[model samples]
Target: MNHPIGEQTVLITGAGRGLGAAIATAFAREGARVAINYRHSRNHAEALAASIGPQAAVYQADVSDAQAVQELVARVADELGPPTTLVHNALANFRFNGEARKHLDTLQWSDVAAQGEVAVGGLINALRALDEHFTTHQGGRVITVGTNLFHNPVVPYHDYTAAKAALMAMTRTAARELGPRGVTVNMVAGGLLRTTDASAATPEAVFDLIASQTPLGHVTTPEELADAVLFFASPWARAVTGQTLIVDGGLVCD
Candidate 1:
C-alpha cells in the first residue's frame, strides 16, 4: 500500500458522516493521523475513530464558530500535532424528511447567505489559523469541497449552488495570497454522488437525470469524489493551486 501523505496530521471538518466520513477514513487508511471534526453526530465520529485505531481522534467544533474553530485546532495540535492538511467539509446537516422543497420565492435570502457564510467564513478562519503554522512549517495544503452546480446551475439547488460558487471564488483568491508562502489552496467539485446523506433528500428522478448525463453511465460515489480530494492533498498536486477539479463523470465538461 502507498504511504500516507506525510507524517503529518490532518483535520477534516464534518467528518462524522457521508463524504466527510469517507475522506477521513481514506486519510486514515493511508496512515495519516486524523482529527475528525464534527458539529454533531458525536457517536458516529467516535465509531469512525475507533475503526481507524489510535491514529485517529474525534474533535467537536462548529466550523462556523471562529472561537470554536480556534480552540478545536489548538486541541488537535495539543494531541496529534499541528495539522498540515485541512479539509473543510462541514455544512449544516440536510433534512431529508421529505419536506416540501422551497421555491425561489419561498427560500429566504438569509438562508442562502447563511450557507455561503458558514462555508466561506469557516474557510477564512481555518486559513488564518493555518497561516501561522505554515509560516514556520514552510508549507501545507487546504482543500475545500465544492459542487458541480456552480457550473451547471440547472438543478435549482439555489442555496447550495450559490454557496459553492462563492467558495470557488474564495479558493482562487486564497491561493493567490497563500501561494507565495508555500501553501496551496484548491477545490474539488463533484457532481451529485448516488449515496451520500446530502443526496438522500434528492428524488429518484433527479438521480436518474444526473446518471443519464454523466458520460460514465452511472452516478459518482462518495469515495470516487474523495479520490479527487486525495489528489489535491498529495505531493503530485504540489504545483496545482487556485483550481477546481470537476469530477462529475464528464457531466459538466468545461
Candidate 2:
C-alpha cells in the first residue's frame, strides 16, 4: 500500500495563491502531476501552472458545488490522469483582522454555515468524485487543510474555527470508512501562516507575539507547512490516517 509521491496525480483545491499555492508547488517539486483548482484567481493559477511546467495545470472549480467538482475531476482526469491525491485547501472568504471580526453575539449561523459549506462540503464533493478512481487503483490519499485555532483559540475566530473543527471530525470519520478501501484521510493544521492572503491583515505585533511564543522562534511560513503536507502524501505515511498533524512550530501541543 505504498503511494509514491512522484507518480501521483494531485488535485489541490484553491491552489491559485497563498497556502494552497505553496502546497501545489511542494507537490510539483516532488514530481507529482498537479491540478491547481481555483474558484477565482485565474491569472495567478495559470501563472503557477506555467511556472510548474507541464506536470501542472490550472482548473477553475467551486469545490463546494457537487456538479462543479464532478466536472473538475473529469477535466483533471483528462489532462493529468485520475488524481490519486486530493488536497482540500479551498477556504471561504474572510479577513484575518480580529478586531473587525464578529463575536459570538453578532456572528450569525449563516456565517459559520458558509465556512462549513466550503470546508466540509468541499471534502464530500471531492471524495464522491474520486471514489471510483480510488477504488479502481486500490489506494488514494486525502489531505485536508485546517487551522490550529481549535486547539489554541488564540483569537477565537468563532465561524472559521468552528467550521475547521467540524472538518477535522469529518476527516477522522472518513479515514475510518475509507481505510478498508485504501484511501487514507488526514488533516494538516497550521497556525496563522506568516503572510498568506488570509493572514495579511494580521498586525505585525500579533505575528511578533506568536513568533516569540513558538518554540521555533518564528511564525511558520506556508512553504514550511506545505512540506508537512507532502509527508502525509508520501509512501512513508502509508500506515498513518485519521490524525491531525499540527505544523505551527510547536506553538500548540495537541
User: What ranges in model 2 sit over 4 Å off?
Assistant: none
RMSD, one per candidate, in order: 2.4, 0.6
lDDT of 1 by residue, 47-163 (tens): 999989999999998888888888999898889998889998887645322245556878898877888766898898888777777876688888999988778876566776778
Q: How many clashing pairs in candidate 2? A: 0
Flag regions of model 1 displaced more than 4 Å. 1-4, 95-99
TM-score of each predicted structure versus truth: 0.94, 0.99
Which candidate's lDDT is highest? 2
lDDT of 2: 0.95
Q: In candidate 2, residue 52 scores what lDDT?
A: 95
Pairs with steric clashes in candidate 1:
none
- The lDDT per prediction is 0.84, 0.95
User: Which TM-score value belongs to model 1?
Assistant: 0.94
